[model samples]
Target: MASHLFVSSTRSFSCLSLILKPSPPLLGVKTLFSRSTRFPRTYKPLVRHGSNAHPKLLSALSSAPPVVAWKSSELSSARDDVVILGIETSCDDTAAAVVRGNGEILSQMVSSQADLLSRYGGVAPKMAEEAHSLVIDEVVQRALDNANLSGNDLSAVAVTIGPGLSLCLRVGVQKARKLAGRFNLPIVNVHHMEAHALVARLIERDLQFPFLALLISGGHNLLILAHELGHYLQLGTTIDDAIGEAYDKTARWLGLDMGKGGGPALEELALEGDANSINFSIPMRQHKDCNFSYAGLKTQVRVVMESKNISIENNPISSANSEDRRLRADIAASFQRVAVLHLEERCQRAIDWAIKIEPSIKHMVVSGGVASNKHVRARLRHVVETNDLQLICPPPSLCTDNGVMIAWTGIEHFLSGRFDPPPPADEPDDAMFELRPRWPLGEEYPKGKSEARSVKRARVHPSLTSMIQGSFQQQL
Candidate 1:
C-alpha cells in the first residue's frame, strides 16, 4: 500500500496528516515553512532510533550510512509516484497548480491580467511582469493551500521557461528556481508550446502520439505532428502574424471590450452580424505552401476601416449608435470568417500531408488561447470532421495558459526521467536559467524532407476543397 500525506493550514495550527504503510520511509526531514505567513514549524522524523530497533535491525542500522537532508536524486530513486507544483508566467497570467502522477489535478489557481488590458490596450511586457511578481506568491500559496500540501510533499517543480515575453518568463523561472532549491526538488523546464500540445493527452486518454496538433495562440500559429514524447515534426506555421494577434488588433480597431480579451469580445460581437456583410479576402489563397500569412489581412482590415471613417476612439463600440454598432459587428464577423477559412485551408493541407507520413493519425488536437474561440473551435471541428478525423480540444479554460497544463506536462516528462538539477545555491536568479522568447516549437522542417513533397502526392477530399474554395470565391 502507498502512503498519503495531506498538509492543511489554519490560523491556529498547521496540520500534517500522514497515513503510512509498510514501505521505505522518508529520512532526516527538517522544517517546513508557510511562505504566506511568517511562522515556521519543525517536524521530527518518524523513524525509530537506537533501542526501539530489534537486535538484527539494530545491527544493520548501526552499520548503515548516516542520512542527511533529502535530495532529488534520493527521492527519485525511492519513489515513482511524484507530485509536481507547476508554475506558469510565460504570458500575461500568473498561474500555479499541484498535480499528481496519475493525471489528477489536485489544485489550480490563476491570476489574470484582464484588468490591465484596457489601460494599456494590450499586454505591456513590463507591466505584465510587475503584475506577475506581485501575485505569483499568493497564487502559488493558494494552489498549495487548496491541495492541502506543502513544498516538502512535492516530488518536483515544473515551469514554463520559454517562448514568451522575456520579462514575464523570468518571473516564473525565478520563482520555480527558488522553490526547487528550498524544497530540494528536481526542476523540469517545459517548452511552452509542447505543454500546450501534450496537455491534450491528460484530458483524453485515447489521444496518442503521432497525431496532428494545431496550436493557435496570441503568439503562435503552429501545425505539428507529435511523434512521441519530446519529439515533433513541424508541418506549418504562421509566416507573419499569428491568428490570435490579428484578432486582438482587429478588436482594438473596432473598439471591442478588452476586459475579457479582444478575441473573446470580438467573437461575441461577431454572433450578431451577418458573416457575408463585408467580404474580407482570404489570406494566402494562391500560396501552395502550408505556411500562413495574416499581415495582408490585417492591412486590408485597417484600410477598409479607414475608408469607412470608422473611429473607435471618438465613438467606441459600447456607446455607438445602432448603425455604427451593426457595422462593427459586420466587420468582426467578416474578419473572423476569413481568418477561420485560412486555418481550414492550412489544416486540410496539413491533414493530407500528415496522413502520408502516419496513416494512423486520426485526431486533430487544437489548443492555445485562440483555440478557445467558439468560432475557431466550431470551424476547426468541421475541418477535422471533413477530413474523417476526430477533433480533440481541451475545455476553453484549459485552452488558455494555465498551470495545470504545465504540471501535467511535467508529469509526463517526470515519468520519462526528463529533468534538470536544481540551480546552484550560489547562483544569482538572473543567471540561473535561460529563457527562450522566440524558441521554435521543435526543429524546423528539414530542407530535403519537407512536407511539401508529401503534400504534392496527397489528395484533399474534393468536397472539403470545393467548400473552402467556394467560400473564398463568394468573398471575392
Candidate 2:
C-alpha cells in the first residue's frame, strides 16, 4: 500500500508499504566519496522484478567486509520500508520523486521546460540549467511530500550523476548535497544510462548480468556488459550521433513537435508506416568493432526531406501536407531500420566480445527509450533468437526516463553496500561537476584511446560464462 502525502510546504513524494517478515530490517547504505576508491567492484546493481530489493543484496553486503553503521534491512521498517529520494535533471525536465525500494512509485513530479524550449526546437543547455535552478528545490520538496515523508524519512538520496550536461548536473548535485547534509543521509551517484538498463530489473531481477545491454538514448549509444552490481563492461560506443539523436534530428527534419523529438515520435510514426516502404542500408554491418554510427542516417533524412520539398523550418509541424506525411513516415521507417541494424550489429559484437572474455552469459537484456522502439525491440528479439541470447527490455514507458528507475537503482546500490558515508553531497569530486560533452562509457583512457584498441582486444570478457562479469575491461 503506497500513497502520496505532502509536506506542509506542498512538497510531494511517495510512501512505500511492503509486506516483510517481522524482522528488524537494517538500513544498508554505502557511500563513495571519491573516484579513485580502488574497491574490487562486483555485481550489476539493479532490483529484482516485483521483489522490492534483490534477495542477493544482503548477502553481497555481508560479503563486503567493510564497516558501515547500519544495514538498511536492519534499520528499515518491519515491512521493509525503504525510501529513495531521486532527482532527474539530466536533460530539459526537472523531476523529483520519492519511491519505495520496491517497484512501487509514491509521488513523481516533472516540471517540463517544453514550452520554454519549444520555440528553439531542442533544449539549449544554459536554458535547461536555468530551468532546473528555478524548480529543482520545489520539485524535490514536492517529491518528499508526495511520499508522505521528510528528508529524515529517506534512507538514501540518489541523483543522476554522470554523462549529462555539466551545467545541469551541477545544479542538481549542488542542491541534493545540501539536502543530504541537512538529513545526514547517504548520497548515491547514479549513472543515467545504467539506470535505464536496471529499471527493468527492478520489475524483473531475474534478467541476470553477463548479458548484453544495448543502451540507446539521446547523446548515448553504448554496448554494455552487465556482469554484476557496480560492474559493467562497455563493449563499444557510438563513433558519432547516438541512435536517439539520429531519431530526434530526423524527427525535427520531418517537423515533429518540439520536446517530442525522434525517440518517442519515431515509435509512433513507425507504427503507422510501412516497414519496407523505403529500404535503407544498415550502417556498419561490416564493421568489426561494437561501435555504431547514426549521423549518416540523420543527414540522409535531411537530404531526403529537402529533395522532397518538405520544409520543417517553420512552426507547428502540422503545417506539412499529406505527401510530406507519407515521406515522413517512410523516412521514419527507413531510419528506424538503420538504427536498429546498427544496434543489432553492435549488440552481436558485444556478445562476441563477451564470449571471448566470459563464455557463460545466460542472456542479454536491453532497457532504454531506444529499446522501446518496436523496430529496435524487434531487432533485439531477432538477435536473441539467432544468437541464443536472452533479450530483455523494460516495458515501453519505463524504457524512457522516470523516477521509479532511480529508486530502483538506489535499492540495488544500498543492498550491495556500493555506497559511501552519506556526505553532504553526491560528488566528492566536486570539480567533476563540469559537463563533459564527451564521456566514454565504463572505461576512460588517456589520449592513447587509439593505441588501447589492441590492448582492449586482449581483455574482452568471456562470452558464455555461468559466473558474473565486471563492468569494463581495463587491462586491454
Best by TM-score: 1
Could you tell me how far off, in angstroms, the CA of residue 164 lies in candidate 2 after the best superposition?
Answer: 0.3
The alpha-carbon lDDT assigned to residue 395 of candidate 1 equals 90
lDDT of each residue in 1-476, candidate 2, tens digit only: 11122232233443332211121222222432212222324222222222344343443333443433344464443125467777777776676777665556777777767665455666689888888888878888877766678876676788876657778877777777777766666666676777887776766757765566778877777777766655666677766677877777777776777555457776777676776777677776655677777777777677777777777576234776676677778877777776787777777767777766778886677776677777778778988778776677788656766656776787766545444444543445453433333344465212213221233233332321111123222211
Residue 409, candidate 1: how far off, in angstroms? 0.8
Q: 13, model 1: CA deviation in Å?
A: 18
Q: Model 1, 160-256: lDDT tens per residue?
A: 9777888999999998888777765667778888889988988998888779999999888888887666567777877778898999989999988
TM-score of candidate 2 against the unseen true structure: 0.74
Clashes of each: 0, 66
User: Which model scores highest in lDDT?
Assistant: 1
Overlapping backbone residue pairs in candidate 2 total: 66
Question: Superposing all C-alpha atoms, what RMSD in Å does each candidate have to the true structure?
Answer: 13.6, 8.9
